[model samples]
Target: MADVVIIGGGITGLLSAHYLAAEGAVVTLVERGECFREASWAGGGILAPMHPWRYADSINELVFESESLYPALCEQLQEKTGIDCELQVSGMLQLALAPEDEILARQWCERRSRVCEVLDQAQLQNLNILSTQFSHALLMPETQQIRNPRLGKALLAALQTNPAVTLHTQTEVNVIETEPLRVVTDHGVVSAGKVLVCAGAWTSRLIAEYSSLQIKPVKGEMLLLKAEPGLLPYMLMCHGRYMIPRADGHILVGSTQQDSGFDKTLNVETAQLLQQHAQDVVPALEGAPVVRHWSGLRPATNDELPFVGSLPDRPDIYVCGGHFRNGLAMGPASALRIARQIVAS
Candidate 1:
């Protein structure tokens, strides 16, 4: 039996395994599908929350802590795994704001002591890639992003090389039994001293009898466009959708939130709508070829803040999930906290 059994292999699970192993705990990480194929690989990897001021302080606390940890984390991952996660400080430009939004943004920046510069349409036009239709825009110079897929690869490689971690891919966990702290899976039952569920959308189903944890699967679709490097120097967000530019001339235009349960089927109409949104913001991308289109499910909680603690009655069973759209931004800190709790116990 392993010291810890993690029931998911997404960012949360992988990071938790990384931390627990560092604390001399033997971890068994199980994944239903290939690791990182879910929301962890599908996300845009924005280091900051979409709008830091819009969310509760709890959400901001985890995200900012993870943001601060990313620089050193990515460096260590690359040093160990020989894979660059492409972590970069690409600023974010927010457009199409209301009068009150501008004021709120400024106030939030002041309170947080973060950079928030307001620019008019003319000043935005000077950037060349953005459409000059919006009255003003907010420039957040400290925002950072990573190539999520690359980050997944790097983390997986690091764990695979670690002696304290055991990985099981394509392993479906049917139920979790707390009396003996064992996981019933397709292959066989694995006993553990402690179990941590970072299963994302499938978290509620696994521990349905243990607690009433409601984690809904929110579907999000994205389109990838190939463009010239430096064409768009920063990430752009308007309404709820955004375009994230990569260091390698690939731009990600995403996404739409729909209550689609666990179904991941792609919709042609949805893709067209996403393309239209992308072209509307950057006219230069009007003729850009959409190289790829994909969809993933984000796990949303009732209170919007992630559940990062143990179950109500089960001290041996813990959870670090329901991060919704901010999973990548919050994964590091959430996993670190949960691992520390398990180790101390």
Candidate 2:
């Protein structure tokens, strides 16, 4: 039996294993499907929440905590794994179509002491962004992002190099028994001194006997358009939709949040609509051929605040799921908290 058994191989699970192993805990992670192919892979990888003020303070706390820890963590992952996750410090450009959120953005930054510079329409002209008189803009220069796919690969590589950690792929966990901390899977039963459920949208179902937690999947669709590097310098956002430009000439435009259960089916109509939205915001992408269009299911909670920390009455069992769309941004901090709990116990 391992010191810790983690159920879920997404960002949260991988990072948790990385942290726990670093703390000298013998850890094993079980994934029902390919790790990182879920919400973590489908995310934009932005460091900060999209319009953070709209979220609860608990959500903001996790996001902010992770923001301070990502740079060092990412640097360590790259050095150890030999994979460039493309952690870009490129600033985020937020264009507001209405005055309400514009004012709220100001308040949000000021209250939190976050660095945000409000750019007037005249200043917006410098970005060459097509906008109307009602549009407002801000530049978050301190914001950071990563190519999530590369990050996932780097994480797996890092874990592979660690002898203290074990990773099991394509292992579906059907039931979890807390009496002796055992997990039943198609392969076999694996018992551990402690069990941590980080299964995201599947968390509720996976740990149904443990908690009455309600976690549902919110489907989001995205498009990857191939453009020349430097075509769009910053991560551009307007009207709640944004385009992320990668150094490798991949521009990401996403996404729509709808409660679509666990369905990950790609829709042509949604792709066309997102493509049009992207082009409408920046005419430069008017005819850019879409390199890829995909969708993923986000594990969401009732209030959008992720469930972190241990389960009640089950000190040896832990949970850190329901992160929704902010999994990539929140992974490191969430891992830190969970590791601290395990190490302390």
Candidate 3:
């Protein structure tokens, strides 16, 4: 029997397997499709706290700790897999279109005590390429971003190369056969000492067979645009939307949240809205050709916090999904914490 069985080969599952294998545990990861080909690969990779002030103290602490762990995680993954995750420390700028929003942004900066600068109209003009519609802006210097595609690919490669770990792809887990923590897949059944489900948006459906936890799928649509260097140097946020620039001449503009369950279709309205918002935030991107448009579902809980740790009734069964929009940003630390809990038990 394997030391641990992780269902869902997204960022959380892959990272959990990496940590477990490194600790000399026999780990096996089962996935329904190709690893990291789902929402993990589709994310924009912004490592910000998603409005740091709005989150609970526990969530903020977790996010801040996770942010600090990224550098080492990136370095180790690059050394092991020879893939660049493209971790960038460029600050994030949250522009305010209304007076209330500007005041809220300023208050957040003050409370956090992070290095933030409030920009006036003249200072906003300095970012000449971006739209001049914002009345004020708050710059957060500690936030960071990463290339999620590269990170996902690297994680898949690293997990495949780990001798202590086994990966089964194209294998969908139909039902979890608990007693001794065995999972019933379409191909066969595999038993492990413990089971951790990180199935992202599919968690609720899978868990419903046994547990009554209510996990919902939140749909998000995003756009990818190719642009030249120095087009937009930093990440831009406004009107509950974001535009992230990459070093490789690609800019990611996103995203719209909807309660459309499990629907991954890219709607025309969402694409148009994203384009309009991107253009409104950065006028230079008005003519930028959109290379790709896609949508993914984020597993969300009622309280917006992920369901980590062991399940109440089933101590041997654990969960790490329901991250919503902050999955990529919080992946590393969450995996580490869960792995430690498994190891200690």
Candidate 4:
């Protein structure tokens, strides 16, 4: 029996295992599929909350804390695991395509007290401005991003080499029992003092009767395009659509949030629409070749906030899932918080 049994392999579960083992807990992680291959690897990796003032208080809290911690955390991961997560501080440009949206964005910035520069049409033209001109733009200079796949690879390698942590891939948890404080699996039973249900999109179905969290799978479709490095220099977001440029000249444009239950297949029509969004933002990307198209299920809750506390009836069983699109943005701090909660409990 390990000290902790975590049920999921996405960023949430893997990071939970990382923090727990770092704190000297015997941890075991079970994954239904490959580790770090879900929404964690599929995200844009922006450390800041998308539309900060529009998000719920829970996301805002984790977003701010994670933004402060990501720099040091990425540095340590690279030094220890020899994997460069490409944590870049390139900042973000939020577009207000409509007059009303620009007004709302300015008001939201004021309400949140976030550092932002309200740019006029001339100022917006000076930047790598979108093709179709809008009212103005909101410049958030402190916004940061990471190469999500690299970060996922780094975390997985760190766990694989850690002697204190045990990993099980292609493993499924059959049922969970409270009194015995153990999870029954097709592979075997895992007994632990604490069991965290960070199973991403599978949380609600897995623990529906055990907990009150109604987690649903929201499918997000994204596409990658090969462009010149300077084609789209910074991240551009307008009307919930975004394009992020990588150091190697590849830009990932995404995504469409569909209530598609557990389906991970990529739709070409949806991918084409995302590609069009990239082209609309940066006309140079119109020539960029299509590289890859993928989709990942974001675990969404009723309130769009993650259930991070222990269960009401079962103090030993905790939950840290349903982060929706902010999973990558809030992952690190969420893990640390869950670790402390478990240790203190």
TM-score of each: 0.98, 0.96, 0.96, 0.95
Scored by lDDT, the top model is 1
lDDT of each prediction vs. the true structure? Answer: 0.91, 0.86, 0.85, 0.84
1 or 2: which has the higher lDDT? 1
Model 3 Cα lDDT, one tens digit per residue, 41-88: 888999866576667766766677788989998999899999999999
> Model 1, range 160-215, lDDT digits (tens) per residue?
99999999999999999867789999989999999999999889988788889889
Model 4 sits at a Cα RMSD from the real structure of: 1.7
Model 1, global lDDT: 0.91
- Give lDDT: candidate 4, residue 65: 84
For model 1, the stretches where C-alpha displacement exceeds 4 angstroms are none
| Clashes in predicted model 1 | 0
Ranking by lDDT: 1, 2, 3, 4
Stretches of candidate 4 exceeding 4 Å from the true structure? 97-104, 107-113
List clash counts for every candidate, in order.
0, 0, 0, 0
Give the least accurate 10-residue stretch of model 2, judged by summed lDDT.
127-136
Give model 3's TM-score versus the native structure.
0.96
Residue 195, candidate 2: Cα error in Å is 0.3
Cα RMSDs of all predictions?
Answer: 0.9, 1.4, 1.5, 1.7
Those runs of model 3 whose alpha carbons end farther than 4 Å from true positions after fitting are 97-101
Which candidate gets the maximum TM-score versus the true structure?
A: 1
